[model samples]
Target: MIITNITSQKDPERVNIFIDNEFAFGLFYSTKEELGLKKGLEIDEETIDKIKVRDELQSAKSKAYHYLSFRQRTQKELEDYLFKKEFSEDTIENVIQSLSQAGYIEDLDFARIYVRDKTTFKKFGPYRIKNELLQKGVSKELIDLALEEEYHEEIQELVDLVKTKYSSIIQDKSEKRFRRIGGYLQRKGHSFETIRKVLDSIDGKDD
Candidate 1:
């Protein structure tokens, strides 16, 4: 096969490679230089096959980087993202290995950070945090460790939240008010027992 032509793509940084006067593949401009590709260069069939694989790998890596730019992703999240984009399994695996080696995708770290954000900023309870982490593909053991580490102050956090949300009704002395407080706490991830204790204390039932 002959490399008959190479033209700039709309992206400018990429070029359309033509083989035997037909569009064969698109490659990054840097790829052209790295591969020493040029017009009228003769390439064997096997070389063409290798070039396609290389190009796909490069493309997959670029896409992964862009996907991870906004926020960290769980390993499964990155794999599913690349898979959904139609990258070959081998390509996705290689890209994942590279990203992991580069410290871009660490499930343990991602889990820890996620738990911190949800607890400190989102004010979510242990149940909700665990569910979210499980959905993100974190392992059960890691999720357990993360929740254990972050949930030590759960009781205080729930107390603070209910106090603020029902500040005007704090001393309303109504069963409905107690149920409302307990429901809000339960929805936020606190267990029913925890909610009951907090509500009981709020209503002076503990006295």
Candidate 2:
């Protein structure tokens, strides 16, 4: 087929490629330039298929990079994002492999950083952080390793959190007050045992 036209899309970086007076496909302007595609240039069907594959892979990588620019993402998250964007499995796998090799898609690093941020900034407990990582598609082994390496539950910090945030309930010194305090901590990702320890410390029951 002979190339008939190359019209720029609304996106300046992209262009619509027409072959034999029929709209063939859209491709990156760079790809068009690199391949020396122009009006009346003769191309074959096999060449068109190859160009489409290359263009799709490039497009998938671009989308993945943009999505990751906002924050670190797990492989599964990127896979889901690319799937939603209608990229083929082969393209998705290629993009993922490329990103992984380039050190842009490290689930273990993402998990470690996530754990540190949640524990330090959000004061989230291990359980809640674990659930959040799981939801983000991090592996169980990586999550456990990250939690072990990064999660240092400062008893004093928990004490301060309870004393400052739940002082009213603490002052009540009733079973109901204990239950409420425990519930709040539990929701914050603390285990029942840790909550009990904190309550005991608060109630002068800690030895």
Measured against the true structure, the TM-scores of the candidates, in listed sequence, are: 0.89, 0.93
For model 1, the local distance difference test gives 0.86
lDDT of 1 by residue, 25-84 (tens): 898888888899999999998988888888889899989999999999999999999999
Give the per-residue lDDT digits (tens) of candidate 2, residues 50-95: 8999899989998999999999999999999999999999999999
* Ten residues in sequence with the least summed lDDT for candidate 2: 166-175
Report the lDDT of model 2 for residue 84: 100
lDDT of each: 0.86, 0.92
Return the TM-score for candidate 1, rounded to 2 decimals.
0.89
